[model samples]
Target: MNPDFPILTLLLFLPLVGGVSVVLLWRSPATARVFALLTALAELALGAWLGSAAPAAGPTGYFLYQDLPWIERFGIRYTLGMDGISLVLVLLTAFITVIAMLLSWQEIKERVPLYFALLLATETGILGVFLSLDLFLFYLFWEAMLIPMFFLIGIWGNGRKLYSAVKFFLYTFIGSLLMLVAIIALYLMHGAQTGSYSFALAELVHTQIPYTTGLWLFAAFLLALGVKFPLVPLHSWLPDAYCDAPSAGTVVLAGILAKTAAYALIRFTYPLLPDAARAFTPVIYVCAVVGIVYGAWIAFAQKDMKRLVAYSSVSHMGFIALGIAAWSPVALSGAVLQMVNHGITTGALFVLVGMLSERTGDRESLNYGGLWGKVPVLAFFFLFFNMASAGLPGLNNFVGEFLVLVGTFRVAPGAALGAFLGIVLTLVYTVRLVQDILFGTPSQPMSVSDLSLRESATLASLAVIGVYLGVHPAPVLDLIKVPIALLTKA
Candidate 1:
């Protein structure tokens, strides 16, 4: 632990503190936006510092670890730490939050103060989730993420806002409850075996239990995570919520919240319940392949841009899940990398889509045509990220998706083949989407401006990240390799 500065604590609470201050100060709307942006930038700077401070190339465990007693009676503590994998994720969270805040600058009008406040609070919750080392603390942060997001959607969303918000809440809430039950069960089991009560994740990881008991507990955790990962059949709530939420909310939802499920599988589920994870691998692999094909096929049928991208996410996230099911070191490492890749590509897509909708007041593919001529810069960005999302070479998504496919194929050739088919389907739908919006004949006389300086700045930053990940992802791969190696070896 670095005693010189409590960097983790600062990262965890700064946004929260800034959020409260924003609300209390609550001056002009412009003031709110500037303050939120500054706070978000500060978090980003701190995240960069943490990344720089991390071990460059080693199987180092958690750094800047702070384990302090919180609930002495129950053996819970305010435990926080970050390893290679977590450091990258923390950086992604900070980057996306800053971009999301800036993207919302003009789009969010009503209750601006409250909107930025919620955004900051949500950032805090997500940061906490990525950093917490205690199961109890993790669960607290897990639910903490939901409250502000629920309000963000309910208050600032478009049509069907209230319905979508409630549905999102209900789905995630039910999942969280199941996870809580599993957590309690684990706590009890650990206490019985070790003659001590503790909610620390590291303590729980060493727990010994019967295969039968572990299987049921793993199922409970998987069910909760499945809903969030939103594998086929369980993904019904996502379209409505993603399509209806404000664009800023959609960026966070797709970019960060959805990825949390994949992260949890790596961080907690696999390590703690290795046997059950292996036992369940086949079924999970099937779901992943199915989701990939299903989401791509459904995305081809969508007319609304937001809904289309939402379904595309279902397909893309399947790749992450597939890598996890493979359980190979290569696959797990690829999955971690894909988590960050998806955040950058998908976050960029949402921002671009939001910019278009903000100007034209419509997001239907049918309503747009020859956008390339009207807003060439927007068209260029749209195509760039579209291709990136399609896993084009020399782009971020390609690197992660390729690694995932290669790693999975080594273990599950049949499942990998199915995923490959989904990839082809994805390319088709992506091109169709781009052609419909950017190259087709106009439905009516069109008038829209190119990307503004602020919007261009956001897209450019994401583009740089995409290219960096595609061409030179070693930095990220290095950071995550040891942690992933540990999980795979376990």
Candidate 2:
């Protein structure tokens, strides 16, 4: 709760500042990466303390909030806070950035300095988004990350890297613009009603805008946020970008970036526009259910491993959305916690896929097999993630998915019916991925080795979480329950 020195500000901005300095002070790519990694490590230490010390359970309201008046005349304040949803995300971002640095060790050979710098900068931006309580600060961080991410994909990525980057930037930029307008619209309306201007989410939520106005504001917010969910037709950018980016970039996208939209929906959007959220719950749920089925069906047909993983995210995010839309305590808590699970499980899965691709010099699933016997450790890691993804009974996914299903069934049986189908599809695709990658006949011997010690440490940590949380999810569930309970009141 200490904010005297603005520790969160330092944690969020230092990497970005150091990354920029590396470019100016040390031109060498290796020097850049070393600096970025060093900065990331420092950030991780700070983040670790914050995360571990965060309560095993939280109040139904904000656990930590810091505010300083920025524009007294207009009622704006420089504010930051962490609730149950945010604590996990900020920790995930810092943790994943370190893992991204490790994964980039060999894959990112050229332009290493700029690459890690942008990656670090992107991490800072994401942290800002999660921690910012002021509407203006939130949007600034939201937009700032785009610049680094655009360069990360466009400059250091694959065949359609530029295309993917631009599409990503454009979609999010436009979507976020709409959200910005909504923020302003909400600001002005509330100012008129309350006789003062304010952009604090807490203050704005209490303004009591008419239902009709709330609907439009919600639409604006969702269109901006929803594009990131890349819901169905809007999801065209995710696969290409995922396929084109290097593994490090893709890892951040899957592990952190995409989840931001869903987090916003749960924390900011729903609370601020509850009536609109309630009215649109069924419609949004329909879209989420479609994503569950459609993303899986499309994923089943992908010949490329990266593309398959990308599509699976589309499917997984649908479940995240379903939990949010259901608005039940168990379901929402499950959804919030599942966001962390997805970060660990999916990030590990993609990292493994990238590792195998590096060994084979190809990403096509048909390239080789018989790896299970040859690379048992690698195969073991791969299988663990696959099981987690499948929502296997003893892994993290099962806890979240089960609660979501149980919660949704109580609220809407038809929507739950569609979601149940998604569970089946999840098993289908995950089992196929495991069988094809791990059990296939050996195509050729790999001169490259299995997981490095550092890599193993990273993967093992993620693997342990998947198992530990699965067996005993009470700790995380406790943190998420109060907030979910508070938000779900009729």
Candidate 3:
């Protein structure tokens, strides 16, 4: 990696450029798929190279920092930086985008080129969110990602696509408006105090805010970020959006998009309003614990496999929230690792479920039976990811969840216990899901094919990563150690 090169800029634009090329250059759907896949592959390679070669830290604890003037009048800049925290998320975004493209290859048919283009555009927005160090830049990316996804769901999704897309838009859009207001307020306050109006995160953190004002501002930011995190009560939009969106759309929604909110909580909220964060710790704990149990309890009753998985995400994300609220070094590390873990495992689950739907033309769990005897390979991968989702010992989710629980127990035992019960519920549903969909006699005669090479390859890659991380997460932990320590200390 050359120090002089704008690697982050390249990473950010590659997908956008690829998307434009897909629209203007590719004539057919087939060529468009190839072009999009190749572009995503290139992005992933670049991310991998950067991850391996980039220095551990740079000035101000950011690697490959880029700061240049964007909107000088308002003190906003085109600032981009990647620390360990953002690095892992960047890689996840790249990896999942590729997976999404791969999953879309055969599934998406009408307006294929447009679909791929929107998907890539969404990628750019997500990558921008992770990399942007300027608050204004971050919010710009935040809203930018929403439009493409809205179209992705509206144009291509299943049952109630338009309704789901609108619901998703309204929830996030309202929250974002609140956040934008808070950002401007913070900028003005900072300017009033220091005569230096800026939306730079580093600068904003030093703003002097009165206690009540800090609490109010933190509440606004929390509502905005929490809507995306879909924290408990605000999560009603998710089940519809997740269940109605196309498989690839669902993967991006559950896998990478939701993680952005959690990431923002770490990057912007806690550091910018430490006093408010401490004050609201108890509230966060309640929401996290409730979300965990409530999500799983609902999931246990879902007849639709996709809906079940969607609700399960609420449960899993709650664990991440729990880890964040714990505010310990170990808990924070677990939350970060869990963000990646949930992406891989849940994304894989959606992929597998989509495959099942493709084969049987149905997503109802009761419609499937004795699939293990019929398609052993698909059954294996399905069970593998399910176990991973259930947080079985020696698997990836277990590592993250264990760390979160252990860390949370040190500070909040009652909340930890509530989360543990949620895990038990998770296990129960996991078994029921596997049994209903993979075992027993079919209710009717239905011919279903097994996994193809492409599908198998897609799942195999995710499975390998899950196993590797489960057995040894030292490399990732090491990468994020310094960043997490700094966050904890602050």
Q: Which pairs, if any, clash in model 3?
A: none
List runs of model 3 lying over 4 Å from the truth.
none
Relative to the unseen true structure, what is the C-alpha lDDT of residue 424 in candidate 2, on a scale of 0 to 100?
A: 94
Ranking by TM-score: 3, 1, 2
lDDT (tens digit, per residue) of candidate 2 on 4-76:
7676677678888878887778788777778888889888888778767654444545666678988777777
Arrange candidates by lDDT, descending.
3, 1, 2
Report the lDDT tens digits of candidate 1 across residue range 1-490: 3566667899899999999989999678999999989999999998997788654443446656778899999999999888888889999999999989989999998899999999999999998888888999999999999999999999999999999999999998898899999899999999999999998888999899799989998998898889888888789999999999999999999999888888888899888899999999998998999999999999999999899999999999999999999999788888889999989998899998899899989888888899898888889999999999999999999989889999999999999999999999999999999999999976776678898899899999999999999999998988887788777887
C-alpha lDDT (0 to 100) for residue 287 of candidate 3: 95
- lDDT tens per residue, model 3, 1-490: 6778888899999999999999999979999999999999999999999988898695466777988998898898999999999999999999999999889888998999999999999999999999999999999999999999999999999999999999999999999999999899999999999999999999999998999999999999999999999898999999999989999999999999999999999999999999999999999999999999999999999989999999999999999999999999999999999999999999999999888887777988887889899889999999999999999988899999999999999999999999999999999999999998789677787777888899999999999999999999998998888889888998
Q: Each candidate's lDDT (Cα)?
A: 0.90, 0.84, 0.94
Q: Per-prediction TM-score, please?
A: 0.98, 0.95, 0.99
TM-score of 2: 0.95
Model 2: worst 10 consecutive residues (lDDT sum): 53-62
Which portions of model 2 show Cα errors greater than 4 Å? 1-3, 54-60, 72-74, 442-448
Angstrom error at residue 455, model 1: 0.8
